[model samples]
Target: MGGTRVRTRYGRFGGALAAVVAVLATLAPVSPPAHAAPAPSVAPDPFFTYAGSTPLRELAPGTVLKTRTLPYRVAGVPLPLRVVQIVFRTTDQQGRAVAGVTSVIKPLTGTTSRVISYQSFYDSLDPEHGPSRAIAGSTAPGAMAAHVETVLMAAFLLRGYAIVMADTEGPTADFAAGPEYGRVTLDSIRAALRTPATGIAPAAKVGLVGYSGGAIATNWAAVLAPSYAPDVDRRLVGAAEGGVLVRPAANLRYVDGSRIWAGVIPMAVVGVARGFGIDLMPYLSDEGRRIYARLEKAPIIEVLGAYPGLTWADLTQPAYADPASIPAFVRTVNQLNLGTRPNPTVPMFIGQGTGGQLEGTRGDRPGLGKGDGVMLAGDVRSLARKYCAGGVDVVHREYPLSHFTSVPLWLPDAIAWLGARFAGRPAPDNCASIPAGNPLTPLAPAR
Candidate 1:
């Protein structure tokens, strides 16, 4: 609560405890170099469109198959730094080994033992909007959102940390598939550390940091590491995430009638359906199908705040009126739920924004704990405490501001927390001090 009050009142990017390098991110003007016009967008190669001969069935999940040089860019301009791309093996939710790519940004000078797998919150169902396009200077709306991470990535680079940006969505661009996100992230780390050109040592220390949609990937990666990617798990010192979506079912309920966030319903539905290979047409009402079709290829930036007061009732058939009643959605969302998963073995830094009402609410119901504009703060707190109970080192912070303000404010702490982990200092455990958060419960089946 003390930490919550501190962040609530003054959510500045660099607080009084600003590190030297973190402050450089704000002071040193970005220096992106000149580059030729972007390559013609010839139906840009889709992620996971692998042409390799080895059947995916025979390879391990972290095998790196291909490599290429990437132009490091911020906005439309490329940076005069070495950037390498690695396409490696990863798994889908059902355990199929698929391919994933990671962008490795080598610092202009110096080497660090730590590698930061910075996940961008590029929330989109379209392939063009994935991280690869952003690296190539695609100006698509969703692709532009990828620049949001470049600023932070620059901070990591300035600190001499080799940066790894994974296309966590996988070949199909499974936007909200939490398990796929985890698998892709862990494998990307594997590809980064093992590849000789990346300059990452065999035992390079790793940490994760993300917000919003990226937070989903970061959290899933942390939980999945111990069981699915034990090699990566042993290397991860800590992870920092803010405004995470721990419970998709609860998020759907929280955003159902929200004035601005309600727009997320259709996007999430379509993404989840694609992630699980489930055709939702039968379950959707006429209006629902139309909405889903429209947003099937839409990006979060283009659609945000566009549709207010949307609801499942407005989209789905009356028979499939209740979202939980739809068996496919219920099952898939349960798989995506982070609360039902194992605790991360490494230390965690989880932050929440508790000002949900900042954004308009069409007919918002109570019970979903105070959220940022989109995610529930109470749910984030619950996940943090659960981590504590499971004996993981946990650092939970809360802010009174809305989601937008919370993102920038939490970075200082995130950077500092991750730094502490890499420094081998013990993270302060809040297990005893943290009051009980919401119960870590799975979504119930429909009657």
Candidate 2:
């Protein structure tokens, strides 16, 4: 939170990725409502009317319509900066908003691209646990928003694209975890369309970009889109996810030992434990519980460095000591098998950190024979091929960057590809033909 305000509103609670599960469980009341209560309006969003423009506007080229608030609601509090909408006027060799570009690009090929949003969560030490949603940046004034404005939104706006960042923590202030991400992402996109400024062609192409926790929303959206938003006229062109942090159990184990991941463990443990009504403080020595709570919302790397000699077994309770009452809770954890799911109707960009693997970390687990760190990029691609057997566009790209870098590098390309598909470009067999297990290496960055 101390760093420059480049953090995107989208990543306001990045630290909560570890703590959200625990926090949500503790905070959400029994029989809580589906959505969070509404928030009161505070300062007027500047982008609400840029240059006297609407949410959907014709702005001067290169003039970023800054800090436009997408109408969003969180339980009881109307977060002033839930989703940041930035509009870039397309330009030529010389910067210009490229008037009439909308019309020229219009009739939008009648292709539909709906949003498939994913949310990140702390690993479930217990398979029966639900995810946490402590709203990391939400409680911290301006911290959450700065992340979105500086990191995520600016990236998209600079590229002449519009961005919708969702504060998916929802109404109860209990983090709904993965499922909520997909719901909120899809809903937010719909909200964007309905917003006065979005002016998205009714059938405009929609693409998803998320990393770490975001991958949860993106992944679920891809799988659920066909069934959920079928009537929206979407082509479901593509999705790109990096540092997936899939296989919740395994991921939990991987980071437990590492100093890098240790900082956020308390938060993750509390989040996951809360789902099962398991409070870690009761289980651990008072000193341990206090240490865990203090480190709960911090980053993982910081955790491990602080407490040396930690392991997965030490942090988590025995699996299945008590059976789960809720079917959703069981499914969220035990059923989090990534390889079995099929690909969407479009191409996919899956990335992994050199140190991270589907098995959760760089170690070897029995069923996950491939070294834990072995990238799942290949596995996801293969799954896509099988699902789209007759025909599907599945491309796998692996970057040299670790989990964090993967998203930003491939995001623009994925968007461009989605744009081409929306423009009536054919889905490619080349993706299918690309050799299996080969990392879809990125093109060298332009000088």
On TM-score, the candidate that comes out on top is 1
C-alpha root-mean-square deviation, candidate 2: 15.4
Evaluate all candidate structures by whole-model CA lDDT and list the values in order.
0.78, 0.41
lDDT against true structure, model 2: 0.41
Estimate, for each residue in 334-434, the C-alpha lDDT of model 2 and write its tens digit.
Answer: 53444444445656666554534432344444333232232344444444455456365565555654454455575666556555654667655445464
lDDT of 1 at 243: 89
Clashes per candidate, residues 3 or more apart or on different chains = 0, 52
Scored by lDDT, model 1 comes in at: 0.78
Best by lDDT, which number? 1
TM-score of each: 0.88, 0.56
How many steric overlaps does candidate 1 have? Answer: 0
User: Could you tell me how far off, in angstroms, the CA of residue 14 lies in candidate 2 after the best superposition?
Assistant: 25
Error of 2 at 136 (Å): 15
